[model samples]
Target chain A: MRPFSFTKIDNAANALAAKKEKSQFIAGGTNLVDLMKKNIAQPEQVLDVTTALSSEIEDFTKGIRIGAMARNSALTTNAIVLEKYPLVSKAVLAGASPQIRNMASTAGNLLQRTRCPYFYDVTTACNKRKPNSGCSALEGENRMSAVIGYSEQCVAVHPSDLCVALAALDAKVNIENSKNKKSVISFGDFHRLPGNEPNRDNNLPENALITSVEIPSNGFQKHSAYLKIRDRDSYAFALVSVAAALELQGTRIVAARLASGGVAHKPWRWYDAEAFLKGKEATAANFSEAANIAVQDLKPLAHNGFKKEMLQGAIATALQQCLTV
Target chain B: MSKESTYSRRAFLKASGAFVMLASIPYSLKAMYVDVDKLTVVPKQALSITVSINKKSYSVPADTRTTLLDLLREELHLTGAKKGCDHGQCGACTVHVDGERVLSCLTLSAMIQGKEVTTIEGLADGEKLHPMQQAFIECDGFQCGYCTPGQIMSAVACVKEGHTGSVAEIKEFMSGNLCRCGAYNGIVQSIQKVANA
Candidate 1:
């Protein structure tokens, strides 16, 4: 890590005002510090914004507004989250370990960089790490890389389990901008698809700080499941994860929200599949067909061709799990 | 935990928060800090901070890049927290910051000002061992013992966090600390013993 000046952020407005060129905000430091250790991120100035942000999880009649600085641990155990948004709660618990979940903030989790081994190794040529240097994962170890929404520049997938659930639930991100004005961006628009600019992860505005995430009321509360398929049962990144939420009447599906992680650059949602499942019988055959539609356009790499089948089975199983609940 | 019960000159000097006082301190006092200067002139970044470790206050001049794990093991001479992996992938450097278990390897030393840090060395009451520590010995919860400190610290917090309702629950909650020697059976037994008691 290079020598850098540190500034203690006093508030959201001052934190934005204090931003200079090559200045990165440090909240949990779970990912940023690791990047710094590997020299992947060398910010000239480090801003500590943990105290400047609120950590409240406000639950209202409309829905839940989770403060950006709220720790992942709090989301797992909070009564409101567990009762009303179990899909989100389960996704948070399924991601990192208890210690990491305790320290990592919600906003930091949303802004997590890909866990591509090539990106971590500074010696390797990674386009995401260095612009136009090269994409190591394109021909390297890409079993965990994206199968869709990837370009020649980068194939790394977004690595947030909470994001998968939030994407499915139609969440909105409230941004505290540099002008001290508030703007809300939809979850889908918040993250980029790694097209021409793989180096840029999200669509965050200039000097923008995420204040909270607003999740509106949805009727999938009773039937929602977050299924993560990983090598280990716990404390491991997902091979493929499915967040299935269904608004069902008896054995008939009224509405559905299906999205997946580890399959694309962003949380890959199957709006077509969701539309196909509407008003249909909530059976294995329908769910299987929906899963097939979800994977129709997936372009898997050599090492991860089996991920298509794995994801197909996972999506079907996750939808079935939601029904059983 | 008390911010008032500190008389250590190192702690007091940092608490004073004046560069002139640091310059006036004796030669012996000058030797106690890590780097007591500026960042622009020198090629190093250092900050004077006051932190509490094992219920003792410390006023030290720390490098801005020093992690809490390095600060504990190198500067403060608290070797209970081991660094199996400096990255957050492994939990060998687990410690309680403000009573919540967090990975010390990722926590910056400058971020810990005015916060209570409890390492494995602070778990016992004087000569008497903590209940979890005593249980680990009875159940033979470790072989190499490299990850024992982290495991015990996480286990203690697991029980306090009400995550010990079952053996499966205990295993899930203690999944952060990895014992490469496959001592999970005994580690789980030790947690069970302490939780049940």
Candidate 2:
């Protein structure tokens, strides 16, 4: 790892002030530390805001506010989350290992770099690591690469299960700008498509600190489910994952929210599929059709072509599981 | 030349060659140790910090880039917390920080100031083994024993966290610590015994 000056900041102001041209804010450091070890990231300074940021998952009238520093472990079992946003709870629990969840913070999870093998290997050509270097995953072993929202520059997917759930439920990111002015960005707008800037993960303003994730009250909480298909039961990134919730009136769907992971640069919110399901019956055939519509415009790579079909099954399964939940 | 003589000559040359490289490393490696210091010796004036580990207070000079795993294994000589996969794909660096199990491999040591850290060395009460440790021994919960410390630490936390309600739950919670020997059955049995007890 490259040697860097480290500062332990006490508040958002200090954290924002500590950011330099070649600096990174450290919370859990689960992802950042790994990146540094591999030299994929070499910062001249590391600003630790673990103490500065609150880890509490606070309850509010409209919804719950997850502190940016909230550990994945704590977030998984928050009473408000489990009682209201059960899908969020399930998604956090489904990710990483126990110790990692205990250490990883919510904002850090959202800001986690992709686990694209080529990205981690500094010797390889990865646009995410070095823009204009060309993407190795486009032709390399890309079974885990993106199936949608991909560009000629990058095919890596955002590797956060929580983000998928947050996108599904319309969670918002609370950020403190460089000028110390606080603002909120919608979940949809927070993460960006790879497009031309795969190097930049989110739309977080420069020198801004993510303070919290606000999950507004929603009807999907009651009929929500998360299903992640992977090579293993745990400790593996999803090949394709789905977070879905339905609002049904009798046998007819009143509303629907869905997003998929491991299929796109950002959480692929199934807005089209959700629109299709708004007035449809809550049946396997209808759910399958919604899944079909969602993945209709996918641009799958050679090795990850299987993810196109896998995503369809995952969506149907997650939607079906919502009724049981 | 005789095979033995040739082998001895080659070995002697290699040893002397390594010695020469080691001799020049202080000056040469400083330029390439990834830092200003000569290799891993971080300057005390720049990054000196205090942290409590295994109930002992330590005010060691650590690198800003050093991980808690490196701090324990390399600095404090606390080898109990093994470094299996330094990237945290394996949980061999599991340790208790503020009474919660966490992967020390990913935890930067400099950021742990004023925080209490507990490792396998501190798990035992002087001479007596922690219940989880005793259970692991009784259940023969290891083969090579490389991942034992992390497994035991995670297992203890799993029970304390009340995640040992069933075999499946125990397995799920303890999935972080991996054993190449595939000693999961025994490991799960040990956790179950401790949780039940």
Candidate 3:
């Protein structure tokens, strides 16, 4: 890793000031440090934002607010999160191992880069690493690449399990810019599709800092599950994961939210499938139809063709788990 | 001034001169100046940080690129924590910071300044081993013992967090720490022993 300067900031203002000087924010250092060692990320300066930001998980008027610096492990057992947004807790636990969950912050997890092996190898030409450099995974080993929202330039997938649940919960991201001005971005608009600018992972500005994520109160708490299908039983990235939350009235679904991971650049939400499930009976046939609709428009790559079927199975399994609970 | 002080000043000047000359050369040849003390050719600047480790405080100058794993083993000579994978994939570099288990290899030394870090070395009371350590030995929870320190550290946290409800739960929580020797059965037994007690 190349040598760099480290600045520890104690407030948001200082953090924003440090960012204006071509510095990357460091929180938890789980993903950023790994990328730095691989020579994929060589920031001239790293601004320590762990101390600068708030780490509280508090209740808002109609929802809960999770501080950007809150550790992933803390959220798994958080009283408010586990009670109100159980899917969020399930997704957090399903993701990384215990050690990584302890170190990785909530905001850092959202800003995590792709785990593409080719992107980590500096010798390889990756468009995400170098614009227009050509993506090696396009014709190389791409079993983990995105099956949707992919372009000729890049086929990488965003690797955040928590974000998938956030997408299903209709969470909002609170961001502060370098000018000290704040804005709220809906969760769906947070991550970007890997079009021409796969290098640009999200829609946040260069000097913006994520403050917290807000999840509005919902009735999906009693019937929600995060199902992650990986090659191994645990401590692995999802091959095809589903975050399903259902609001039921007797045997009928009053409302539903579903999002997918490992099949798209961003958390792929099937609004059509969600709409179709509303008012439908909570049965395996209905769930299977909705699952089929979720993957209807997918265009899988050569190695990841299996994901087309895997996504359907995962969605169905997640919905079944939600209903049984 | 003493004679020793004067000699040290001259040595510092010589090293600075050599650094200036070597900085202009290509990075590939910068290794030639590795023998120079007090002044080494680094691509980026160094920062001085004070870190608390195992109830002791250390003030040292570290390269911004240095990780907590490297600082503990290479600088402080605390080789108990192993680095199975420098990346966070493997859990061999697990340690507790502020009472939470985290990956030391991914943690920058600068990030843990003024924070309490408890490694495997700090788990016991002098000659007395921690309960988790005793359980591991009694249950034969390891074979090659490469990942024992990390496993023991994580097992302690798992029992504290109340995740050891059953053997399956123990296996899920301890999945982060990988033992290539397939000592998972014994590892689960050790965690169960601690949790049950």
Candidate 4:
């Protein structure tokens, strides 16, 4: 890795002031340090914002606010999260490993880059690494590439299990701008699809720091499940994962929120499938129909064509688990 | 505004203009115009950091790019924490930071300036091994003994965090520490023994 200067920021103002064109915010440093070691990310300066950021988990009357610096393990083991937002806890635990979860922060988890092998190989041409360089994953090994919302420039999928659950739970990201003004970004609008510019992963503006993720209270707390299918039983990225949450009135589904991972550049929410499942009987047949509808619009690549079938099966299994709960 | 100031400003503008013009040229061609000696000169700076490891405080100068694992093994000569993969993939560099288990390979040395770090070397009380260490021995939780330190550190944490409810839970929580010899059966047994006692 190239030599770089490190600055410790004390507050939001100092953090904003320390920002440079070639500087990066280091939180947890799990992904950033690895990228730096690989020479994939060569930031001239690193701003240590972990200490400046809040790490509290606050609860309101209707929702809970998770601080940006809250560790992934803390979120997974938090009493409130395990009790009320079990899907969030399950999703966070499904990612990485125990040691990684203990070090990774909540905001850093969302800002993590894609795990596409081509993107990490510096010798290979990757649009996300160097703009207009051309994506090797487009024609090379792309079994883990996106099946939907993919462009010719890039086909990498965002690899965060927490974000998938947040998308389904309708979580809001609280961000502080350079002007010190705060704003909330809905989870759906946070991550961007790989269109012309695959270099830009999320819609976070320049000098805007994420403060917390707010998850609103919902009736689906009792019936929600995060099912992640990977190459192994644990400590691996999701091949096809589903976060299903249902609000059931007796046997009928009053509301449903479903999102999928490892299939798109962003968490692919199946709003159509969710609508179809709402007001329907919570049964295996209804879940199968919803899963079918969810996978109908996927555009899979040559190697990742199996993801479509995996997506259907995962969605069905996730919905069945939610209903059984 | 002054005559001397205006003259100096013009000189500054002319020098900056030539520098920008030279920089705009492609790297292969810019070498022809730039002096090799001047082009080769670049500043390299290392930051001073003080970290407390295993209850001992050490002040050292480390590059900003130095990871905690490198600082411990290379600088401090604390090699108990192995460097497997060194990319946070394998949990060979597992250690306790402020009483929580974390991957030292991924953590920057500069980030843990004031935090307390507990490595494998600090697990025992002088000659007496930690209970988790003794359990690993009793259960034969290692083959080549390469990933043993990390497994023991994580096992201690897993039992403390109350994740040793079952064999499946133990495996899931200990998934970060990969054992190439497939000593998972013994590793799980070690954790179960500690948790039960």
Candidate 5:
């Protein structure tokens, strides 16, 4: 790794001041440190934000507020988060391993980079890493690349299961800037698709930092879960995962919030599937119908053609699990 | 059991303590300490750290780039935390900080200036072993024992976090700590032993 200066800051102003000098903000450093070692992320200075920001868990009038620095392990085990939002808990649990969840924060989990090997390998021409360099995953091993919400410039899958759950549940992020000013952005727009620019991820300014995530007040009473299908049992990223939350009014479906990961550049909201599930009886046929709507207009690469079917199966399984409520 | 393997309890305790010291401490500090002739410790520049470990206080100066794992093993002589993968991909350097389990390898020593940390070495009493430690031993949860500390730390947190509802739940929750020796069945059984208890 290249030699660099490290500074610890305890406030937003200090972190932004360091950022002005081109220092990268380090929260959990789960992703930043790995990239730094690989020489992919070479910042001249590192600003440790773990000391600056304070994470909290509180009840919001609208819902719950999860501090950005709160670890995934803490969130998964918190009584409120577990009881009120099983979807979030399950999503958190389905993520990386125990130690990772312990060190990984909610904000960091949301900002974790794609799992595309091309992006990690400095030798590969990945547009996500270097714009206009072109995505090698398009022609190379693309099994885990995006099958939906993809652009020609990049097809990398968003590797975070928590983001998919948050997007499906309509969570919102609260961000603070250098001036200590705050604003809220929907989780749907929190992560952007690979447009002309793949490097430009969330609509976050250079000096802006995430503070907390607020999942909207909803009745997720029982029907919700995050189903991640992977090659191995542990320490593996998802091949295809579905985050679904269903609302039941007797036997008919009152509402549905569905989002997919490991198959999209961003957390993908299946609006068509959600729209099709309204007022329909929760059944095998309805789930299959919703699955068809979810995969509409999907364009899979040669190696990831299996993902399309895998994604469909995952969605079916997740929706069926939701029906049990 | 083999006759040669029947070691006495006193011999077992002495051997375990030595193993703990070797596993946790850096090679530089492995030398015996002299009583009267005190060794003058040259403090590193521009560093003043006070971090709590296993509910005890410690004050040590560390390099800016030093990771918590390195600081524990090299500087403070608390070496139970293993450095399996320095890249945070492996959980061999797992420990508890402020009642939360964390990866010491990914964490910089400077970042945890005022937090409580707990390593496997601190988990046992003067003569009594922590329940999780005892369970791991009884269940044969480790082979080479490199990843045992991390596995045990994660297991303690797993039970405290209520991830012990079912076998699948425990497996899913504890999946982060990898065992390259393929002692997962024993590892899970060890955690289950404590969780059930």
Candidate 6:
């Protein structure tokens, strides 16, 4: 890895000052260090913000507010988060192991790069890394690539479980700039599709830093959970995962929110499924209908024909659990 | 001597003995307490700080680039905290800073000034083994043991953090500390023994 000067800041203001000079902010450093070793990311200076940012958990009458700097392990283990937001806790727990989670932050999890093989291997042409260079994953080994919201330019799935849960929860990100100005954006808008510029994944400016993630209190979260299917039980990325929250009035669905991972450029929120499940009788048949709507438009690659069925199964299983609970 | 003086001396000796016994309790139930605010690393700018580790105080000069793992292994000859996948992917370099488990590899030594740092070497009495350490031995929680120090440190924190409720929870919480040998069954069992005890 290329050596860089490390500066420890005491507050957000100092961090912004360093960002103004184009220094890279290091949070968990789980992803940053790996990319640096690959020469994919080489910053002249690294701003270490682990100590400066406080890891506090605040409780409101309605919901909990998690500081962006709070470690993933802390967020998952917090009593309130575990009781009220099991989906969020499950998502956090299902991710990388305790050591990485101890260092990885809640905000940093959403900012992790895609696990597309081409994106990591510098020899391959990845549009996400070098814009318009051509995507090698398009015609290469793409068993783990996307089957939804994928353009011909890129097929990388967003490799994060927390983002999928956040998408379904309608969480918001609070971002601060060098001038100390703060702005908020819903989690859905935080990550973007490849579109024409696959390089830009988030809406934040180069100098903006994530401050916290705000999850509003929603009534339907009582039966929510994050279920991931991976090749192995521990320490492996998802083959397909589902985040589902449903509210029911006896047999009929009152409200629902759904999102999927390991299958899209962003956390693929199933708006069509949401609309279909609304006011419909909540049953296995209805869940199948909603699942069909969720993956009807998927365009699978040669080696991943099973992803379409896998995504449908994930949606079905997630909905079944929500309904049963 | 007065009867009261003899009685007080006997009581004092008994209390001291109990205190020693309390400190020597099975490592699993032992509380590894550390203070975070008072921690600071050695200085590069001519500001010297002394750090106490395993009952010994070391006054050393260090650069900003130095990490706690590096300072212990390279400068102090405490090579127990192995540097595996230095970017924090592997927990080979986990240590207790202020009683909280942290990746020493990712933590800069300068950040730990005046703080008590505990490694695997600090987890035991002179001859008696820590319960978790002994459990690892009996259960064979490791093979090659390159990641043993880190695994033990995380296991200590895992019990402290109250994540020993069930096997699934233990597996999830301990997932951060990877044992490449796939000795997860034994590792989990060792932690369960410590937690159950």
- Models 1 onward score TM values of 0.91, 0.91, 0.91, 0.94, 0.85, 0.84
Candidate 5, B90-113: lDDT as tens digits: 789989888778888888777788
Could you give candidate 1's per-residue lDDT for residues A186-274 as a string of tens digits?
Answer: 99999998888999999988689999998998888899999999989899988999999999899999999999998888998989999
Please, what is the whole-model Cα lDDT of each candidate in the order they appear? 0.91, 0.90, 0.91, 0.92, 0.84, 0.82
Local accuracy of candidate 2 as per-residue lDDT tens digits, A191-304 = 999999999988998879899999998877679999999998888999999999998888899999999899988998989999999998999999999989988998888898
How do the residues B1-197 of candidate 1 rate in per-residue lDDT, one tens digit apiece? 66566777787777777867766898876565434432233267789979999999999888888999999999999999999999998799999999999999999999989999999999999899999999999999999999999999999999899898888899889989999999999999999998899
Per-residue lDDT value at A19 in model 5: 81
Model-by-model DockQ, in order: 0.38, 0.34, 0.48, 0.64, 0.23, 0.14
Candidate 5 residue lDDT tens string, A1-325: 5445678888866777668544688888788778877877766677888767667878778899998888887787688888788898888777787777778888888888887999999988989898899989888899888887788899988889889889998999989987878889899888889988888777877778988899888877589978888989867889888998888888889999899888888888999999999999989999988998888778999799988888888888899998674
- Give the TM-score of chain B in candidate 1: 0.78
Better of 3 and 4 by lDDT: 4
Most accurate candidate by DockQ: 4
The residue pairs found clashing in candidate 4 are none
Candidate 2, residue B111: lDDT:
77
Per-residue lDDT of candidate 6, residues B142-164 (tens digit): 99899999999999999998999
Candidate 6 wrongly placed segments (more than 4 Å): A61-63, B1-71, B87-90, B108-116
lDDT tens digits by residue: candidate 4, B79-190:
9999999999999999999988999999999999999999999999999999999988899899999999999999999998999888999999999999999999999999
Ranking by lDDT: 4, 1, 3, 2, 5, 6
Ranking by DockQ: 4, 3, 1, 2, 5, 6
Off by over 4 Å in 3: B1-43
Which candidate number has the best TM-score? 4
Model 3 Cα lDDT, one tens digit per residue, B1-45: 777886797799999999998777977565645645314434767
lDDT of 5 at B150: 92
Measured with C-alpha atoms, the lDDT of residue B186 in candidate 6 is 91
Q: Calculate candidate 6's fnat.
A: 0.33
Candidate with better DockQ, 2 vs 3:
3
On the 0 to 100 scale, the lDDT of residue B190 in model 1 is 94
- Candidate 2 lDDT for residue A103: 90
